[model samples]
Target: MPKCYWLGWSGQFEYLERAKQRLALVVPLTLALIFLLLYLNFRRLTETLIVMLSLPFAMVGGIWLMWFMGFNLSVAVAVGFIALAGVAAETGVIMLIYLDHALEEARTAARESGRSLTRADLHSAIMVGAVERVRPKMMTVVAITAGLMPILWADGTGSEVMQRIAVPMIGGMVSSTLLTLIVIPAVYGSVKGWRMGRGPLREGAPERMAA
Candidate 1:
């Protein structure tokens, strides 16, 4: 017999039902909050949307990993999901910070040279920002994943308890790191392109600014 039977299966089901009901409220409200925050800081809807999309791709990997590990989807895992939301948000914020810094650097350079920052300059800045940001983020994720691996792989000493939390966290962190490093940059680039292609009438403004 399985040592740990699924606890509160009925209650779990009920909790899920309640969660489902609340999701309609939760999602829009959460999005509104994020939008409001982003608007207050950056005032750009397109950038916010791009950053948000990167989160789902990261979550896809996290979910697939948990399923492959034969872990039951439970309240603990739901907690992991909540943790992932914060992780994703943090990753987006870091990426945006790097991007903004890069843009600022490029603008300063352009001003010094008495030339407007071109599309190429902007692209270069974004690339540099992504590269610079990725190293530290990767190191952080690696350290976290490495620290948790033992717990996830432990054979005794109540390893099962640790696995429940550690597995999803490690998985989510890994996936979130990858998505933030790759997908977020791609999304940012695409948004930048779309903004640039809008022509000279709207040139020299950030895409997020346009939104």
Candidate 2:
């Protein structure tokens, strides 16, 4: 019985290896192109850098969870990570857009109130932006997780394969969603600080503009 089980496991591993090799070429090239596009489109070094930095945390968390689950690094897991990159990017884009809108609104409000923009205003803007955006963001994550729940919990008929892919994706999505809301803001703030501290770049800008 053990011999038969070993043979079956070995066969499964061999099949996974072949699938991985085929996927490897496509995945790396696709990721490279996506990143290149992001870099080109954003233009600003600080903004681009923040996006790049925040994007990988999700994969890190997903892979960490996979390891904890004692799963081998299979092609399914690789695919999950690839899918996560897109998801993380989407979340980042949404957060950044909302942040920008919040800042603009705050600046407008400050100007109308005869108050100069200051660091406090910037912080308040971000807080307000986060609060306003939280509902949609949470809903997005919940909806995605809910949609994928069946595959994650599915039994029989390709369940093993589904589990492998779904587990990492779910983990990555959840972790990335939280990090996008929290860590990305912090990173944006830090970058804003460094830029402001350099002086001229921040010249004429409201002192309150945090990020």
- lDDT for model 2, please: 0.72
In model 1, state the lDDT of residue 96.
80
lDDT per residue for candidate 2 within 27-81, as digits (tens), equals 8797777677666655456666676677678787787777876778777777777
Cα displacement (Å) at residue 76, model 2: 1.1
Off by over 4 Å in 2: 1-14, 110-116, 200-211
Error of 1 at 103 (Å): 1.5
Q: Which segments of model 1 are wrong by more than 4 Å?
A: 1-35, 154-162, 199-211
Which residue pairs collide in model 2, if any? 117-208, 118-207, 118-208, 119-207, 119-208
Itemize residue pairs with steric clashes in candidate 1. none
Task: For candidate 2, give the lDDT of residue 55.
Answer: 66
Question: Which window of 10 residues has the lowest lDDT sum in candidate 1?
Answer: 201-210
For model 1, state the Cα shift of residue 22 in Å: 6.7
- Which 10-residue window in model 2 sums to the lowest lDDT? 201-210
